[model samples]
Target chain A: MTYRDAINAALAEELERDERVFLLGEDVGLFGGAMAVTKGLYERFGERRVQDMPISESAIVGGTLGAVLTGLRPVAEIMFIDFVGVCMDQIVNQIAKVRYMLGGQVEVPLVIRTQGGGGKSYAAQHSQSLEAWFMHTPGLKVVIPSTPADAKGLLKSAIRDNNPVLFIEHKLLYNEKGEVPEGEHLVPLGQARVVREGSGLTIATYSRMVGLVQQAAEGLAAEGTEVEIVDLRTLTPLDEETMFASVRKTGRFLAVEEGHLTAGVGAELVARVTKNCFDYLDGPPERVAAQDRPIPCAPALEKATLPQVEDILTAARALVG
Target chain B: MPDMTVPPLPPETMRALLQGMMRVRAFEEAVHDLYQRKLLPGMSPHLSAGQEAVAAGVCLQLRPDDYMVTTHRGHGHSLLKGMDAQRMMAELCSKETGYCHGRGGTMHIASPEVGCLGANGIVGAGLPIAVGAGLSIQYRGTDQVCVAFFGDGASNQGTFHESVNLATARKLPVVFVCENNIYALSTNFARTGATPNVVDRARGYDIPGVTVDGMAVEGVYAATTTALERARSGQGPTLIEAKTYRYYGHGASDHRPYRTKEEEAQWRCSDAIQCYGDLLIERGVATAAERDDLSARAAAEAQAAVDFAVSSPDPDPARVGDYVFA
Candidate 1:
């Protein structure tokens, strides 16, 4: 199944499993979502459960937060992660802080599903990875799934979590097909999956970057450099144990991410490994991330700016050296 | 236009309305005193001393299951909607016994039991939330209506326009109540926009918009009653702009440098509590002595709440991370 199909399956299954679960966002109902992830949900759940909202991003988030406050579990889509800037106050201040600020009296069981990444050449306004922005927030749970099965499992988990969660889907990974589990599949959040195992080096990444790093690791293995790849399914409650264990075995670490290099998720991972697993390190930790600049619409510039397989291989080689 | 005639309510009902207004007034008065004593932390209190009638009128029409979202200056609305005074005072004092365990101070008090979703610190933020609650009610097939209490300044926010349009498009059960106190902090309402009245802007949303004398409790009650009826009957939302005024400045330390003393005196002459009390006595709903006694009781209740807040213990420092998640 494709990652898009897996997300749709998760939403459909959750909607069927719980009566309080509903979908609300722009083009979610009639247009079947901006990326067709919610295709046919309107017909299946009807218009009442599958709601189409206005172009207002603030209302989409604020409305979903409000619905969660009162007895409904709503999965709201922001279409793209770049557009989150329009509703930062609602996402950052209101949704992220509501549960904690309310002293746990109310549980904000809300899932904000948005797409990020820059390979499509959608220009500066549309294609920017902003996972670091949410990871910095205190009361939010940020999740970015790299594979079809993990996407399905992690989305289901995010919907079930009593706190608000930001479920980031990479736009580039939507068409990537893989074997997703058939029935009752649930991947517990805050748990990392070791996709590829090796003793030479540990390559940590998530979302679309995981695929690039895995490919790079395969190429590195051809050169006698066995690189282990760890896919962090969730970011905020980061699977530090799995990361630390992988780094301890490998004695070398390289963090890869599609977001900006400055204060990005890769920076956080590299910092964590340096802090906890310093004694086990064979060499200094390294990071492979996008350059500190907006993603341009030109394909060449965008590809150059984003972290590619070659960049990961270079970072892995440096860490091994 | 608002119906200025006294609502033909029973003597007990009228007395209750007067007492509700008095409670709001007394509560805010005590908040002013508490701030003066430096007991409350964070931002200074925004008192709703002259706007009690709007709170009494609108909240009295709501059932316990009906939801409400208020603005930063929302103490009056919360109190009238049945929020516990002790817990509210505790919240103002930043104690663990507060509504939000001292995390959400004055601007973020919320009580789902009382149907208050929360008090928003951002201008016009609660409008969409109220619309969402309205959508939830419609989805669940409930008769409950969600009331959004915003200031006139918030009416200028894009959220106000967006939420009203969505509520109208979906025909949701939500009432947009604009408490037009004529000032967004220092900026006067007239200086902010070309439209003279907030209700006039509701025409673009295709909803019924009405203006009521906010200082007159009966007028506000009558307007809100009609709006609630329309919402409960699935007639969609109504924008009711209450023409009110704030007797105090924007915050506790704000001296009235923006406006003249004469303009302040002009608004104070139509204070909601004083006018409502006079109306109650004139209509023979209650004797003057009875009205005075009710006011005194309200003051005593406010004092008791302050005492409870003062005696409440501070939150344990060890449990600071208790409510970050679920």
Candidate 2:
């Protein structure tokens, strides 16, 4: 199934399983979603279950928090991840802190589905990775799945989670096809899967970066450098055990991410490896992330800015040496 | 508008309304005294001392299961909506026995049992959350309505406009209650608002907008009931602008540098609790003795709450990480 189809299936399955689960966003229903991730959901669920909201991001997020507080598990879409700036207060202040500050009196069982990453030359605002923003928040869980199967499984888990989750999908990965489990596929959050296990060096990444790293790892393997690829699916509860164990074995670490290198998720990963596996490290950890600038609309500039297959190969070759 | 005749209500309800105002007034007075003594920590509590009638009048129309979201000055609404005064005071004291286990202070108290979603620290933030609750009710096919209580200052917030437009567009069952305390923090509504009334803005959303004498509990009660009926019957949201005033400064320790003492005194002439108490006696709902006895009881309750807070243990330092997740 395609990544988009997998998400639609997960939504359909969750809606079928739980009566409380519903979908709402700016073009989710009738429009079949902006990316068509929620295609055919409106027809199956009807208007009551599949709500199409106005272009009010504050209402979309804050309203979802309120609904979850009152026993509804709503999957709200923000159309684009960049649009989150419009409703940062509702997302960061209200939804993120409501559960913790309210003394755990209620659970915000909701998911904010938004797409990030800069492959389509969508320009500065539309092509940004903001998973680190949600990871910084205390009460929120951030989920970013790379493959179609992981996408379906993680989305299911996210919707069923008792806490607020920011399920980020890559706009470029919508059509990436993989064999999604036909039914009852559940990938737990906070678990990093080893995509390519090797003995030489560890390259940890997530989302679309995981695929790019895998391709780079195949090339590195041809050069007699065995690079292990760890896909950090859930960023917040960050599976430190898998990362540290991989680093401890390899004695060399390189963090790859599509987000900006400054204060990015890669920055945090590198910091963690340096602190936890300092004595085990053969050399200092390296990070290959997007340049600290806005993603440009030009194809050549965008590719140069973001981490690429060749960039990963160079970073891995240097780390292995 | 109908004549300002007092609607005949059950004697018990009349007495409850009177007692509710008294409780809110006395509770805020106690909180004010605590601030004066430097017993409270963090930001000074935003007391809803003079605006008790608006809370008493509007909340009386809600069921225990109906949801409500209030603003920074939300003590009155939370108390009237069934939050225990002792726990509320304990929360203000940052004690473990508080409603939020001492995490949420005066500005952030919440109780799901009483259907109060929360009291937000941000201006106009509760509007959209309340609309979400209304949407929940619609999806669940329940008759419940949500009351979103914000101040006049929040009327200009983007959330206020977005929430109202969305609520009316969805025809969600919500009552947008604006406590027109004439000021948002220190700025007067006259300077901040486009019109003298916050309800006039509702016309833009095409919802029924009504203004009531927030100083008079009966008038507020009547206006709220009509709005509640309209909401529960699927007629959609109503904007209620309660022209009220806050007796104290925006927060504790804020002197009246923004307004004149004469202006403050003029507005306090019709104190909600005092006027409602006198009206109860005149209508034969309660005697002067009964009113005095209720006031005494309210004072005792406030005193008891303070005592409870003072005696309650502070939250455990070790469990600081607790309650961050489910």
Candidate 3:
């Protein structure tokens, strides 16, 4: 099945399971969502459940937070993750802190689903990836899926989670094909999967970068350099054990992402691995991230600005002692 | 949903509502005097001097299970909604036994047991939360309703517009009680916008909206009961704009520099105590002696609350994280 269809399956399955689960965003209802992830939800689940909201980004987050705290689980879609700044207070302060502020008397089981990454050349405002902003908060859970199966499984888990989760999607990975299991199953948060096993070196990534890591692993293996690949589906309760185990096995690590280098999730992972497995490391961990600049609208500029398969290969080979 | 029927409530009901208003006015007066003596500390207490009717009337209609989300200028609302006066006062003093363990202080008082969601220091932030509470009531199929009491200043915030639209659209059971006390900190209503009446803004949401006499607790009581009945019956939301005023400065820190002395005097002349006493007599509800006795008793009650607050033990600073995450 396609990655977009699996997301659709998760939405349909969630709506079928709980009467309180609903969607609210611009063009979510009749238009079937901007990426068509919620295409049939509007027609099947009706407007109330798979809802359509105004272009008010701040209110959308606020309203979803309100809904989640009161009793319902509201999954709000911000057309693009770049516009998250519009609702920073609702996302950062209100939603994330409600559970903690009330002294844990309340729970905010909310999900903000938005498309991120800059491969589409959508330009400045529409193309920036800001997952790090959410990662900076204490009470938030950030999830990104590279395959359809992971999308469905992680979304199912996010729906049932009692904390506020930022369910991020990549613009380029939605249509990719992958094997998805049928029926209800959840991918637990803080669990990392070994997308491919190797022994010479380790490469860890998540979201769209998973494909790049896989390609880089294949190319490295052909050159007699075995690479252990790990996909950390969740960033918050990070699977530092799986990462550290893989790093200790290979004695070398390389982190990758589509976000900027300086404080990206990749940097955090590398810093933690370096600190935790300092003696086991064969070489210092290196991060290959997007250039720290606005994503230009031109296809060539956007392509060069983001980390590609060649960049991943180059960074991984450099990590080899 | 039940229809808005203006019922002639029991005579004691009006007396009860009026008494609540008097309690608020008297408490604020005491706080004002205490401020002059430099006793109160922390956030500037925004007195509910002329705006007592809204809280007293609306709280009178709420069931014990219903919830109320108050604003920064929320002493009247929190007190009238059954929050213990001693705890509230202690909180204002940042005492250990305060309503929020001193973290909330005046603007952030919260009581889960009494269904008072934390009073917000930020404007326009509580409306959506109240809507969420109402949604919970509806989703769980409970009889509870949530009332959000905001001010004229909060009415201009974006959350007000979004929450109101969402509430009316979903037909949620909630009340948007606005105390239109003429001023937003330092700016008056005329200085803000052309829509002089706050209720006029409610029409855009298509909810039943009204403006009532802020002086008469019965007027507010009657309106609040109608709105509550509509909400409890699953009808929808209502906007009640109580055109009241505050006699004291915005906070204990204010020197009354923005407004004139004559303006303050005009509003102070209609002190809720004097007006309610006159109303009870005019309606033949109570004798002059009884009213006098009630007034004295209320003063003593206020005194006891103040004593309890002053004598209450401070909280241990070590266990600050208690009840944070269960």
What local distance difference test score does each model get? 0.91, 0.91, 0.81
TM-score of chain B of 1: 0.98
A52-119 per-residue lDDT for model 2 (tens digits): 99999999899998899899999999999999999999999999898878888888899999999989
Tens digit per residue, CA lDDT, model 3, A233-297 = 98886889999999889999898888999899888988899999999998789998999888889
Worst 10 residues of 2 chain A by lDDT: A99-108
| Better candidate number, 2 or 3, judged by lDDT | 2
- Residue ranges of candidate 1 with Cα displaced over 4 Å: B3-7
Off by over 4 Å in 3: B1-9, B23-49, B82-105, B111-115, B134-145, B206-208, B229-235, B287-326
Residue B42 error for model 3, in Å?
5.4
Task: Name the runs in model 2 displaced over 4 angstroms.
Answer: B1-6
Q: Deviation in angstroms for A258 in model 2? A: 0.6
**TM-score list, all predictions:** 0.99, 0.99, 0.88
DockQ for every model comes to 0.81, 0.86, 0.30
lDDT of 2 at B73: 95
Please rank every candidate by lDDT, starting with the best.
2, 1, 3
Looking at model 2 chain B, which ten-residue stretch has the lowest summed lDDT?
Answer: B1-10
Evaluated at residue A148, the lDDT of candidate 1 is: 96
